[model samples]
Every structure is written in structure tokens, then in C-alpha cells.
Target: MLKLYDNEKIVLIIHKHWFVMARTIATFAALVFIPPVILTFLPLATEQFDIRIVEPATNFFLSLYIMVLFIFLFLLWMDYYLDMWIITTSRIIDAEQHGLFNREISEIPLQHVQDVTIEIKGFIETFLKFGRIRIQTAGEREFTINFVPHLYEAKEVIIKYAHEAQKTQLPVTSN
Candidate 1:
């Protein structure tokens, strides 16, 4: 849950699809099983090397490797899970987690939004119904939300909000 401004209500919280996390998940799964596979071949290596020293060293290194892998995967998951685009009734908030220590959060008022572009490129992205949404603001600042699911719907929502905000900001003239 993220903190919101006074009177601001969240319209949508968009995150990258599960498909985007698949590669990292698959790689982590593969690495988790690799140690055992390599251990199976340890006996062959023991014929040339001393078992007493090799066994303890191998065990220590493998344990350290697994610990490192777990930390790496956890960080990767955090990066994916923490990064999000929050669209509220009044504005859009972009929160990006570069690493455990580095994070950036920016917000753009709905009235500042000038254009919303949705790009569904490549066969996989089109087939999966996930793509990139770029919101161009009045000051030429572009906020890009990548690998977002239901991109068109998100774009439509943003456009609707922007129009609403623009209408409210317009001055009423007498006939």
C-alpha cells in the first residue's frame, strides 16, 4: 500500500505482468537445481583431488553460492514487485525500485498530461496483451510504464482523467 495525497483516491495500480517475471523465475529455478547436479559429478573429480579438502571446500562454496543466489533472487523479486505505476483521480505516480537502496518516485498532475501513447510491439507482447504506455506531460517529461498489462484500458483511463482534470481547470466564459 502506498501513501496518497489529501482527497486523492487511487483509480488503478498497475504492475508488470507475470510474463515479465517468468524469465527471472525460470533462471532462479534452474540455479536452485544446479548445485545438486554438479554434486553428482563430484565423485569423479575426487579421483584426481583430495576428498577431505575438496569435500569441505565444495560444501562451503555451495552453501555460500546458494545463499548468494537466494539473495539475488529476492532482490530481483523486490525490484519487480516494488516498481509500479499508480493512477489516482488527481495524478499519476511512478515508483521505480532500482535496487534495495535506490528508489525513485515521481508524480505528475493529471492536468499536466498532454498525450498518452500505447505501444504494443512484437508478436509476444501483442499476443500477451501487454505493452508499454508512455504519458507525455506539458513540460515534455515522459513517464513510461513498461510491460504493463491491458495497456489500452490503462491509456483510456488516463486520457479520461486528463480530460476531466483539463475541464475542471478551464475558465468559464460568459456568452
Candidate 2:
């Protein structure tokens, strides 16, 4: 029987770009709704409307508009937050967004991983699920994969791979 190197319990990706969920919400608020709200109240913008003639009806419509905007913003955030990629010792895969397009998938072998680093910065980042993972290999120079949650744990996973590459001749946890 072919033995797997890291079993699901021993090694796996716990989460994805989880921070993007919050950021996606904030982005929708800032990008979609805020602009329209500002335009609605602006003197030059709203001046085209006859507020005196359409007061009560306008108020109802305006409230509805705000409600719709909030819903759209929430949905937009949910989509972004949900987009994620994960890997375990058993397999590698990608979760991605393509406009309104939903999840996309991709994968590679653990043997491809060369170096890994976990970077945590800023006060909010330290408190939140925000940080980076850099993976280096002989095949590609590109590194600095961003917005990975629980960066330290991801680094540990990579370190585990390094141990396997060396046939676990040396302790991986040591500096």
C-alpha cells in the first residue's frame, strides 16, 4: 500500500483568505453604497429631484434604496469572504473568484515547496486573521502569497514538508 506522507489529521490547510471576507464587506460599503449615498444627498446631484412635490413618496423610496444598497453590499462581501484556497497532505487546491464566477480550483505537489515564511504586521493584523505566506522553489521565483489567514500555522505546514524532504533527519521545529 502507498503511504501518504502527512495524513489529514497531521497536516492540512485549516482556512483560506478569511480576512478578505471582512475586507470584501468594507469594500462593498465603500465602493458601491457610499458613493450612491453621497450622490443622493449632494446639492447638485439631488437638485434634479423635485423634493417638494415628491416628499412622502420620495422618503419611502429613499429608505428602500438604502435597504437595497445594504443588502447588495452584504452579498458582495459574502462572495469575497467565501473565496478561498486550501491544501492538505493529501492534495492541493485553489478557491478563487472570477467576477460573478464562483469557486475555482487548482493544485500542486508538496515537493514543489522550497521555502516558507510567515509575516505578521500592524496592530490590527496581529489581532485579526491577516498575514502573508511566501513560498519559494527552484521552478519559480514568485513568492509572497498574500492574505493567508493564520500565517504562522501555514509556515509550520511548510516546515513539515521541508522535514519530509530531508527524510526527517533533523528536527523541523528547531530554528
Highest lDDT against the true fold, candidate: 1
> Runs in model 1 with CA error above 4 Å?
48-60, 170-175
Off by over 4 Å in 2: 1-11, 14-19, 23-53, 102-104, 127-129, 141-144, 161-175
The TM-score measured for candidate 2 stands at 0.60
- Residue pairs with backbone overlap in model 2: 21-81
Q: How far is candidate 2 from the true structure (C-alpha RMSD, Å)?
A: 7.5
Model 1 worst lDDT run, 10 consecutive residues: 166-175
Residue 39 accuracy (lDDT) in model 1: 95
Count clashes in each candidate, considering only residues at least 3 apart in sequence or on different chains. 0, 1
Model 2 residue 61 CA deviation in Å: 2.5
Cα-based lDDT for every prediction: 0.88, 0.59
